[model samples]
Target: MSNWNGNWESFARDAELAAKERLNEVDRISESNQWKVIKAFQKHRVSDFHFNSSTGYGYNDRGREVLDEVYAEVFGAESAIVRPHFVSGTHTIGIALFGVLRPGDEIVFVTGKPYDTLHKVLGHPGDGTGSLADWGVGFTFVPLLGNGQVDWEGVKAAVTPRTKVFAIQRSRGYDWRPSFTIQDIEEMVGKLRSIKDDAVIFADNCYGEFTEEREPTEIGVDLIAGSLIKNPGGGIAASGGYIAGRRDLVELAAYRLTAPGIGGEVGAMLGTTRSIYQGLYLAPLLVGQAVKGSVFAASAFERLGFETHPTWNDPRTDLIQAIRFRSAEHLITFVQAVQRAAAVDSHVVPEPWDMPGYENPVIMAAGTFIQGGSLELSADAPIREPYIAFMQGGLTYAHVKLAVRQVIEDMHSRNLL
Candidate 1:
């Protein structure tokens, strides 16, 4: 690609090679340490890859029984609603917010800004006239610290008796995108609840699942939410959203979805328990490997003379690390390079596109339409000038290494070495 040293092809190769070397080291932990805990909750595998719950539900559908098991396992909740409903991650956050609060009540988002989609779903006026403000409901945002941690003091100031929900987001792969552990949320919830007993501490738990030392629900979140397709579904669950919390909270969310069809948390396919089930089984291992890949890629990018976020050897991550290309053209071309390298499907092409709910026009090199930024199969990078986010999901960490190689090769082919 370059002097055989500077080009990305060589970079990707070296990165992938590094990943292979770590396989035995990482797999040992994946197969034994992580696998043992998830096996008790295992149902079955599907599509030669996905997991089906013991209750026989495939993608967390109409059957409430299996969802219960998943909730217990992931959130330590008595009940949960893990449905292939809610078109995307943002929709899921909206459902949880609506499920818990009344019109007169308020929701104090503890952790600063949410994911871009969630930011829009929460109805930011900056997104151009939509959302809770259009309706009678209220929404407020609390700023984070310089380091990106929550301004707990500000949260305390914002919480009033009118605050029915105090929400903290766990997934750190968006906005400022720095990973925070579940322990962070647990401690936040504890502090918030100590002040207000009736308030529900909520978590927008997205790409951050299975990487934490402890689950948020175990620590104290009244409700923990995320996309089943992202972390829990093991890169399966064609599409879905999940909410796990206290039993009453889950039931309340269900009622909101059913009531007047007020909340549209339902996806076209009500049942794919298989994909989600398998996703969970492969989850621990896939996540470990993905994290490992991130570490490797971050190091390679640093060596490539690019600014990288999230160091390569970090013990914990939300599963995304980005490098700055500094120019719009470079960002788009980089995305194209990675996509050209990753997917098996020839029909899928990488292109710049806009998302439905972001303030700025976010471009991505996505191959298919399973919601462009899906944390599956790889090769999707969202546009951030001077920065392109390379993320992975739904595939083995081994696959992530291959994708990294492809990205490096693509970079070399384009002569950006």
Candidate 2:
């Protein structure tokens, strides 16, 4: 609760009170909708791929249908498609770009520096296998400013008659910093529309979903893309990607979706109906709880002299939080402790190895029961300096407290404490 930038104790008190106030506001705002949907959500069985649904179904395009309802609730935008086949966030983006642009058209990446994988996708390796550059489509970047936000003037400079799309990525990373605010998106859209009404305005809606009450879909973005496996997957969705956008673009995406696995253009539902649905249902309350856990972890770590990224005093935050240790061994140790913190009756050790397509190695303490990232199960990934000592998943505050304690205990056991 304390704000290290100023008076600490007073800030802590005020921050706590404000947080409680916000919680009250959220409850009041979501009262009817939250109760009806989330309570019922508890009734839905946890979805499983091995036993319950199609073995290789595409992410539920039907999921897109649900996003459609969200769109109507938010923007007046026309259609949506959610597919489980987008193996990673990268694939989902590829599908959206391929679906929207003509072979000879162009797209401008509005993000200053997007996800690491995206640089390649935007034609970085002009001749590499499956590189998007082979398509003859042109791409450009809207350089970001020092604070890690889009440079509006640079964007205008990047625009061209050939530019068929403008896209922004929102997700977890250490490359610049957080840039896309609700206001930034709105302003970007205004600029795009003024430049060219037909130029598609797209956003990579990843870990950022449920971060705020109002989403880009609600703010008039032409298309919003994201991964279910990360957020709405709710530790349930086996795998999937979703695109909610202009009706025609969505329809075209369905066609490209054919090669992936959704049954040739009608779209792959990826048997995610129950899981994605369930994840979405539990997301709001779960996300709120995650922010709380993050606040605790961030504050505690910051107080211990490690650099941290979040504060309980801030408005609301996404589930992810980072604590930089500045050393690979320390990073691994931190991840191990965090995982131990989550296990109630058992412990799991994390392994660090080189990830495919990753120039640098990535480490993860994956203790998931379902063979995927499970918030319900505790885990952490520390990639070295700026290592994020991150953790999420505790059904209640008590559960999170236990996890936090155990993690700290592990650190003490090793004398890292």
Candidate 3:
């Protein structure tokens, strides 16, 4: 088990001991979540017939329709639209926004600037990609306070009659802030309702699903959107996204996804129905493993004198574990080392390049079985100042533990540890 400078054995021993209790807790949560999903599946009578996929116009797709119902029931939403047509998490979120917002309406972001992919989606007027701004919708953001908590006073000042939507991002994108919990969302929903009774509150629920027993929709969020490849897909959903919430709001999103008349009635599943259902069935357990890996990684990094966001003991509502390095080289090496430890593409090296939809040159180490699947073992970071590397996901805790050890050994060999 010795690696790099040969001190990894000692570190691994400590990490295992330190992470024992946390891992047990994760196991407990996984059990509860597994039961919940099982009940949802049973309640919906998901049988082999639901596994069949559709093609062409995809009309009379009972499996597709029932999957939505099961998801709605599980999430406690009035209605849901789950489709392979929606490309990524950002695209699903875009559909939801465009579906609800009208021309001259304003969208207020209470969680600060969103992830890089969103900048293009929220493009300025005439950028010509048919962005919100191009559609004559306005955007405003209220920066979080020094502590990364939402600024209540700023949100109050920002809300207006024209503010049709108040958006909340549960996961802290590339930022060093803590992810918002269910309780936090509940409070935000309550406050927003008081401020503007009619304002729609949409939650970007990417990477946050299954981490908590309850979802944002269960707590009164007007609408919620997530990518299937991230959390809900359970690492098996090849492609797709989900938008669930109030029936009217979901219907609007469905129109955007398909057409004004077709809505969710059309769109073929194309043989992905079974995988989607199975993935959702397994998501809770996989998410728990990922969360445990995150906790273990955070503790391991912190023990070695590196700074980790939402320390190991902190209540986790997402899978991201951000580790700050003193230099860019240290950060880059850490990412490269994770790639070296990959089960799929271990031989391939990753370099920082101009990735689409990102403002900065980014480096990503994703050797997942499913291309671009973040729920599997992966690590990525922007080549930027402060040199923070965000590591997330593992299909199994054993794999994540191995990846973290490899990173430590690589850093130690370079005397960066």
Best by TM-score: 3
lDDT of each: 0.63, 0.60, 0.91
Error of 2 at 224 (Å): 1.1
Best by lDDT: 3
lDDT of 1 by residue, 1-417 (tens): 123474556656665565465544545555663654464465411132222232332223333445455556656676777776556667777777877777667777777766666655566334455465444456677988888877878878887778888877765644545666766666777788777888888887787776654677877778877886676766666777787888877778877655644322333343476666666667777776666766676767666676666656555547666666656666766665556555544345556667665655555544432554345545444565445565555355555566656666666677775
Per-model TM against the reference:
0.82, 0.78, 0.97
lDDT of 1 at 231: 69
Candidate 3: TM-score?
Answer: 0.97
Worst 10 residues of 1 by lDDT: 44-53
Residue range with the least summed lDDT across 10 consecutive positions in model 2: 43-52
Better of 2 and 3 by TM-score: 3
Mark the regions of model 1 whose C-alpha exceeds 4 Å error after superposition.
1-29, 32-39, 42-63, 124-130, 260-271, 344-349, 368-373, 379-390, 413-415
Cα lDDT tens digits, model 2, 366-391, are 55544445345354553655555555
